[model samples]
Target: MDKQPLLRNLETNQPCQPLSPQLLSMAATAAYPGAPQAEELASAPPAHLFDNVTGYEGTTAGGEERFVPPPLSTAEGAGRHEPHPQGAWSIPSITEETAREAFIEYASSKCCYSAKPAKEMVFRDLKSCNTYRYRLESFTESRSTEWTSEPYKGQFVDSSAYGPAPLPWSIIVEIPQLFQDNIEKVPVPHTSSIKGCHSCMAMGRRACTNCTATGRVKCQFCNGRGYKFDDRCNRCHGIGLQCCIQCNGSGTIPCETCDQSGQLMIYIQLTVKWKNNVLESVADQQSGLSADLYEKMIGQNIFTDEQVRVSPIVTFPEIQINQASRKAIQEHQVQLTRTSLVIQQRQTIEFIPITQVYYEWKGKEYNYFVCGVDNKVHAPDYPAKCCCTILCAVPGDLPMASGGQTVPPANMLDKLAGYESIAADGEERYLPPPVYPAYNAEGGQPQSNQQWSIPSISEDTARQALIQYASEHVTYSSRPAEEMVFKELKPYNMYRYRLQSFTESRSPEWKSEPYVGQVIDSSGFGIPPPPWEVPVDIPKMFEKNKKKVQVPNTASVKGCHKCMAMGKIPCNDCLQTGRVKCRMCDGRGSMLGNDTRCNHCMGNGVESCRSCSGHGQQKCDVCQGRGQLYFYIQLTVKWENNKFEQVIEQQCEFPTQKLSKVTGKELFSDQQFQVYPILGFPDPRINQISQQGIQEHWTQFGKTSRIIQQRHTVEIIPVTEVQFQWKNKEHSYFVYGTENKVYAPEYPGKKCMIL
Candidate 1:
């Protein structure tokens, strides 16, 4: 087992390391005053010396806390008072007193004592029962905190499936007349549903007039040719014909009423919803919204102006729009919008009671804390004493007879003081006590010894005897436990935002195109018409001229030629053969005894032509070599490039905004002490005394005699606590919150007849 360190350094606020056991000082202090007796000083068992020293079955393998001896209680010396146990002073007194006087004649006529003269002396203990006072001033404190809030308000936009046609598109609408000029056609549902389309050629029953009921036409791609590029008309398989365009080889057209699926499309409503966030504020549980927030909240775009407002919402009247509330005489339309604001405020109080105590005991005054009272004394220092009463009498003896009791000598009785005694014959008798001991410096009580009397207390044992006497005066008193509560107002402030909900969904405007006949137009396409006979046409210009010239000739001969610049042709100087016989030497081995040509041809018997070096022929200029002349004509045709119009869909949109709110709250509690009314103690004179005795003596005993005295009081105190709660409520609202939405539609492309 391990033990926690007892003390910590105030500066570091950390546990102080344990010093060597040798560092520990003497345990005695003002708190533990008065050394123990010799027997009590015996070595204490290790179990009592420190925690974990003995009876520890725990294993040391685990880490343990270091134990440091508590710094010898230096706090004891300061503000030190008499050493006492807890609740000792607070213990009440439980003692009562009784006194009775009675005089009675002896049962037998002859009496040994005087009945009438017999007196009952009652000794009353006087205790003011006044107590020490105490005041427990309550000390309370609280901690507060604040922070910025995160806005969690926002709009929830949901688009659900169309229901019952709130607003819908219709398939039974006017359609453009394909391949026809200047026409919009509306077909009868009953007839057009079953009959073939007029121009489209529906269900195989209707023969295509364009294809002559054969559903075929000439193969324009191959011009009725069987092969690719006029080789074979693969597209028509040599038939030179193909399926008709109008019938698409089906010999029939699709009906528009059924949309070619044999089933008609049904229209339903399309609903859009705009809602606020459902979650609550993280800082507080209060709702950031109020019924009034919904008032005048409907903004533009939620509902169309054409779609009459016919009481859309009535369940919450506060949120309902009041047409009469419009101050502008209802001339202008209402535009609903929502926004939130933060409302802030600040609020502070103190509760502490006064308390004090005063007390006195044994002629000594103390500010607070009780030690003795209630008709009882806490004299742990009272010395024990044993005194005997002696009845004095004149030195006279009764006649020695058979019925008489034995008596001691008058010389022995002469030492006695304040003792009363009697013989069987009713005559008083006496016996003497031993001489008293010498007086000590204190001179409180005298000591004497006698064989027939109680043993005398020795001076050496005076202190021990006084302390032991405590058991005789010790007593107990009771008091009930108590509690108290003190409170004060603490001011606080808070800020927050509120949110209001208006119309979840609405349309501010409804736009529709009026019915009008529209003709398919391709005239804007810039396509020109082509004509062959008796027709006006545009002709392309051409500029051409021809010219011819004769050739110089053709030759197969070699070098120095236009086509053959070098190589493979024999040198002209050497004719068809390469050897020139060395012009300088004229075929001789040497000229004038020197082989000049040999040096020129490098010892080879051949000569190379500079121009056609040693080759026989010259190059021909005409035709470059042995060739022909070629000419080509370049032609470019130009006209207007057809520009076709592209089909594109148009787009439109509306803008809207979302909103939310934030909130916060605070609360606190702390403990403090409270002091109630002061408590009471018993007065010795009024309260009862259970045990009492008195002693008077002689035999050299001084005229002075001593008695015990004491007094005290108790204080009452209890614990208490204080608490507080604060809250700031607002609402969850929105800004820029309208039936914010977006929608788009597609239109089909129209076509005109081919011209």
Candidate 2:
């Protein structure tokens, strides 16, 4: 896989020779079969999984390049390949044997250490001292230079940030005004115009059909003769017929119960209106942003009406309850009970606001990150200077030079790489030493002494993940925390980790489970600790004390007894006697039948509260019938973590930068990933304190890299010494190039070397 994108490089700006297959040759025809030869080059190691990417781990004695390509006379007017900074050093094609011979000849005929080759040796031990570094810088102002930031959008319902909130509903608001307003908005026929139409006693008819105009009808019992034989029709009293029962013997019966038209009037009270439910979003009115749906309008009245049903028209997800919300429903006075001003069909909106800041100072550029929500800097307290922090220096297996007196066991070559050459007593000196000089890149500017970087994850976010991991891993606790968020509980969570071991053999044996331990959180327990035990009972006493807080109870009801838990899943049918008016007669006592009160509901028209069985409430079950419970508690359990879920390693390829104008001393710090054993190590204290195998990761990318000017040395051949044996005689000569005076080739080197 191409890891360039994944691999974060230090970008120390060291120039390297490109790998090429250019063969070099130096041989004098068969005349001098002396097998004379020259030229060999050492190539740099390929990119590999080295402990450090910068490769600035060890202090090397050969601090600077020892080769210088003689200035080219390109314009003898002829085009020529640009001279490699160290090209000429491979000159005359000096072979390894020739170099070896030259070295032996130089050592034997010259001074100092012996030239004899080191004794053949085989070393078995391989060690690596890898140091981790972090870069942190602070600025007064800044803007993103080259970054691909992501804006995460979220949505939540909060009481409106502006205007009023919905709450404190009244249970008994006057209905006269509302009644009048509703009448005007939606008018009905006037009661005075609803005159009744009366008719003849015969069912609204103008005349009785049985009697016609006479309004009297012949008695059916006596026929037309008014006689029934023996008793003279005792029906008609002998001579005539009985008066007409239909018209009561009158010519025209009057129906005074109603007008001849028989029209009747009706009345009703309008229960619902537009103001009954209002849904306002940011677009409609200034509001706040939230991650989850929660009650936003606080201290506002929840208008209710007797005529209207009890259920709210709108609802919000119950996540967490703010303290102010609880108090608002409890302490705030009810504004109206006539009708509930329900929130319905809310129009939610969300946006992730990115604060892009820019600034400039002195002649340099940088940025100041003022974070959102948390109001913190992305990288706070970062240093404002270039850093060449030494990760960790380790001397690998290096060859030891034979000390005519005593041979050193260490690899002289490898050891020499981390330090400048120091002259030995008499015959001692740093090995491979051209003895290059150290150049201060940022002159007059203080070099960064510490190593730190931004974390791949924010401390707050990481803390939450760690706490969750620890909760699963630890074997001891009254109740290990779960689904925990930062600052939700009092105090903090800290733990001592143990590396578990399980036997794997013919008979696999169980080894460890979650360890058992008690959380020393004074506030986590339901019972309060004694005054003297306050400090000791708290976990991370010093650190958490500052952030210690009281979390509101999100588990149960608070505020209005009628609504129960604010507007959050509060009880709609709070009364065990949950009841409503009978639907018949429109809750009116009277019905069309017999124009009398309804017998089913005993004329009340309101049935027994079905929800409450006519009672106001059932047992207070959520609160255990107590109506209250502790606000918070730490869940106790034994941590059963058998293995680590995961370990992350992240790096950035480029350093972030920006332009700024504010001034302040930047802060820098590093997060140490040192593990300390509490029950497993021999010396618990020592094992915990010693950072031997710490796997520290510089996860965060620098917000801004400190720009520094480093001093470098370039190679040049002012004069080259050429020696050879010709015609049985040894002779030396010199080749002087172009005065080679103060040449400038935009060379990779910073200083000029006289070769």
Candidate 3:
């Protein structure tokens, strides 16, 4: 019979491939750091060995059973109720003088208002209408299990070696105190088992995929052309191939699944999660005040109850409050009990008062509401009206005539002639309305019709603005902006279109290769679905995700191609000679001085090949020396959100890039699984771009990938370009977006280096 080839102990007869004593010691120590020595382990009793197992415990006296906590004792008088308060719950009303003062203060806050209406308007009546709010909290704890694994480092195995492993849920673990939100992970005792690594089949190494087991790979520097720009490539020295970096020219890598130890420790891990769930509701007062305003206010705590589970309040005067509590408790129990354990529940009731104030100005009537203990006001119509030109005037320093009455300057009186104001006697009065002229007060043609115009700032205000701006920017100098002549203020507005294409796509490719001990995934073994037909759940938009699955009916075994079924290949290093020319003597059989014998080769001129250890052949990496191959198809599912944005060109100096950092008022928004192009948008450019984007995405990605979802939106970004003059030079700044964010790129005072 032919001599059997060596497998695990290939280095036994070859000195060139001798195993290192230090390496073996380190590997053994790392595998079992606290394990007893081989002799001691062999002599130790079975019971002692089991006791030493990590995260393992002996079986309980009873069979597998879920552990349940003892029931909580019910508190006495848990459902008792208190009688509702008599009379309406309302705060004292404000006096007429106080209301008038509030209106005057509100008027003074505006830059353009004359404050005449506030000072003269008479109070008709004061109506007080008040509202109430309620809240509930539920705290819960939940438990779950999942399979987890780690490298087997001689850990105790309960299955097969010891006996059947303990059930996952039956494993005992310490439960944390309830009510507080927390999480804990515990490994189920006696559930761990040892399995041979499926990746490398206990060989501790795998063929390097990058080099295809040849110990060399194409040079990336020259794209494997051996030359770059008609010159010899320095990276690969014109050889076209370089030693594989991944395997360090060994053509093999340590198995990651087993951490190079060739075995895996598998166990079940239990996760205990604690959570606090809260629900709230409010009662409507029909006071015409916005319900949302009540959210910011705190109310009086009329009733309080704490128990394992509290009953809904039935004695409350408001039917809505009682019904809201009942609905909340029922909903929490139905939703949470399905997945988590309810630890404790607490509920409380609060009363927030809202009062609406009604007052009349001239002959017409208007009202303002005061809410909560802090007296927050919501007055959309405050009676006082003004023109946009007032934006340029200094706040709180309105132009005044004699007797404290606000009046326009003689120069502006002509401009205010066309506007009319209503007085307290229900008659028309001639009052100066704040006017923002296109030209300066000195009279000149407007700078740009495309630009928005605001009143020019006074020299003092300009100086203060420069000082504040310079303080914020470390590289700025305030001298230039402060010394320059104050000029005109111009504003510009721009719009942009943003299209987001969120797609979930699947691509299938035939992947046939030699198999080792990989577990066959037959989950997709039925009729394969078309790439586009595969149903996949949509994930969060704009998030990139990827997953792979084995294609159905595409797996098979075939003869190995690299070795031609021989399971071995001639060693490339020695070229099947089993020996290589001695490096010390250069294959001359003698060293320097002619007669000096080659000690390394003993004058033979050749040494055993280090790569194959003089065996003339190496195990085929393609089949892992198995002489067969496993062919299959792999499907890759990718979720990607492609965002395309285009800003319409503007006729102003505002930087388009600045709009990206700030959010604008969304003019139009649409989202769907697959969206149609937008139509009838106010801006024709927006409609055109929407159509172009949809078509381009379909043509580019739709052909190769399935489209999952798409969302597109248009926004009117408020861009106010303010142009001003300083020291006879013109400068501009931008006040953009609803937030009124300022962006001044070319401030007159910048680039000043501080020594």
Candidate 4:
């Protein structure tokens, strides 16, 4: 059955490489390959269950290219030519249960030296010496016209020159120590290691979004005001001036309340966040570029051709955090004496696994090694078919013919065509020459805003298309018909309807009233009306004048003509009806030193009815309750220079007050910082140290034993391999690619071995 095509790579025209079964299982389970720690389980040999383990436990290495799949092709004929699968180096798959069992068993394996429990095996720092004593060998003088870098006694400047001298390469080797059998039996000394760091909490640096690197932003609310204004005044129409509605007079209206202070209460709230991470170190070296040190400079092609081919001895160490002390840790030291090594010429380049040797310098551990820095620069797309070699003078060796090929340029790009073709997408077209107007018979053209060549009208189809295009392009044009617009139609219709309502036509009789009322000047019979009104007594006289008569004391009722003629009431205090507000009581009932009635009640034999006081009636406080002092008022106030004297029908109020204050800095400090851990190994401390393998035999005094051999050389090369493992009776596999393939041992079984 045809399988679905793997995800297409964006650049290369290939399906994404399938994940190895091991990786697929890992992805599904979210588990990672961690170093085994159990000692007892690992010490149990797998040979007991499976006599022959065909697979080797080692790291694979190779170079890889990034792949990006091309877009899907539609040509039916091309489908027939699908390429067969080309598998690459990959990891083997294993079930979780199998991997777990394997890890535990591996961790429990006995130490390689003593065959003792691995769990009980402890790591100890090895002391190293930088000084060395060596007898001078016959130095060979080597020369080349081209200059190369060398150590100097003078300060180095760009113009510094290379001094003539015998080939000055030096090499040193660690005299691998052979520990006595009793060494394993002896207990390791108590480490008592201690480390110190600044005790203060780390300060985080937070980004300022508001100021955008300046650490500040403008206040959006209140425009940065500490407070805001809300209430608008109600009196004088908010203009601080009033005009009378009755006579259009400009004066203060006598307030029935506090006589017009014209003030109103207003209220406002603010919010803010704290800028806590202002000076904190929220992140560190994680932001810096990272890679495995040994994996990078040593295993990877980080070295230049001169640094590699001339084969400079690399001295970087594998340093890790000491689990015991939380301080840096190192194993042993390695020194390469110039006389002890050689740089062999090779026709092809390869990857070499980094040997786990330790060194020490300044009381720290470092790992160092010597390897054939194969001519990486000399390799081509198909691997080097020809060889380029440079032979430096070697001590104690015959002065071999003093002739050899010169070193090639570091970047020999001429040999590689794959990278060049990949970069060429295609050539672009050039534009044609511009057309010039013909010089017609004595042609000198006149310029006009209106040109005769322009068409006055367009074809209907063309015109309709242009109109539609214009309507679409000019989004805000109101001339576009409603049917032409693409949005829902209701809001537009409502908007147009509202606009039409503003200019609606009016009817002629809309403002005219249907009925009217008039003012009368006369009261009942021949009585006078109010004093503010003109007297109508003459109009009611009917051509006859009645004799003027004095009102009897008993006829002193309100509105009585005789009593009014006597001028008994104060006009401001009374209703101009012959009655008066009693001076002794101020219009309230009961006068002092009298019968709570009229003054004459106790002395002149004139008594009040008491129920009505001496005036025969009481003023109502509840309607003032007797109805004596009652009056109605339609209250008016000037609001924004307009008179609003209408009696209030209803009123409501919303009460809110300013609760808190917010500053601009607080408002802009709401953002937070995120942090992540640093990747890669830190620098080492020492140049040389010693580490004795526990299971491996070590050299004893004066023993020519193969197991204890000292002088040996191994050629290193890089190779790619596929990875697989058995899980649940099934094989899982994966190929090494760009992200995974790194330098490993040349010997698949020995170098770079995991077990």
Candidate models: Cα lDDT each = 0.23, 0.25, 0.60, 0.20
Summarize candidate 2's per-residue lDDT along 1-755 as a digit string, tens digits. Answer: 22121112458534322222231112111322332222111111111211221212221211121111112222234432321112111101222233334334433543333433211111111111111111111111101111011111221212123323211121122333322223111111111112222122113333333454354445455554445654556655654445655566664444333333333221111122323222222211111223222222121111221211122212211111122222223221133222223122111112212122232232122332222222222322222323343555333212312211121212221112122232212222212212223322222322222333311223344333333433321121212112222222121111112121111101101111111232223322444322112232223211212112222111121222212322222223532335667767668877754455564675777777565466554443333344222222111111111111111111321111210111112221112112222223322342332221111110110111111111111111122222333334443322222221111112111121212
Question: For candidate 4, what is the lDDT?
Answer: 0.20
* Per-prediction TM-score: 0.12, 0.16, 0.37, 0.09
TM-score of candidate 2 versus the correct structure, residues matched by position: 0.16
lDDT of 4 by residue, 1-755 (tens): 33323245879866544343344333323332331222111212112211111121121111111111112223212222221212222122223233223323443342222212122222122111111111111111111111111112232232212222211121121222221111111101111111110010011121122232222222222222222244223332223222323222421122211112211111000011111110101111121212223122222222122111122112211111012111100110011112122111111111232222222222122232221122011001211123344666643232212111111122321212111221111221111112223213222321212211211212332224334433322112213221222211110000000000000010110010111122222222244221112211221211212222211111111111212222222222222233444444555455554433333232233333343434533332122122111111111111111000101111212000000010111100010111011111111110000011111212121122111111111111111222222222222111111122121112112112111
Q: In every candidate, how many clashes are there?
A: 68, 96, 11, 77
Mark the regions of model 3 whose C-alpha exceeds 4 Å error after superposition: 1-475, 479-489, 519-526, 534-537, 677-684, 728-730, 737-746, 750-755
Q: How much does each candidate deviate from the true structure in C-alpha RMSD?
A: 65.9, 46.8, 32.2, 55.6
Model 3, span 1-755: residue lDDT tens: 23222223555653222233344444444665554333111211223222233323432211222333322334322554432333333333466676667666667777776687767765544544554577778887666655556688886765545555454445566556655678887866656666555455456785566665568767666766677787778877877777776687896788776778977676655666778888888887566655577778766566666666777877665678889989998999788776666767778777665555665454345677666654556678876776564335433332322212122122311111112121112122212212212212222211212232332334455456556666544346778656666456554556677777776665555444567766554325555444444455666777889876765545556566566667877676777778998999999888865565576897799999997899987887767688776655555677877776777767886656556556776666777655666655555787678777776776666655556677877777766655677767788776666655566767776542212
Question: Candidate order by TM-score, highest to lowest?
Answer: 3, 2, 1, 4
Off by over 4 Å in 4: 1-88, 92-94, 104-755
Q: What local lDDT score does residue 688 receive in model 2, on the 0 to 100 scale?
A: 38
Alpha-carbon deviation at 259 in model 1, angstroms: 5.8
- Over 4 Å off in model 1, which ranges? 1-214, 218-220, 223-230, 244-248, 259-755
- Using TM-score as the measure, which candidate wins? 3
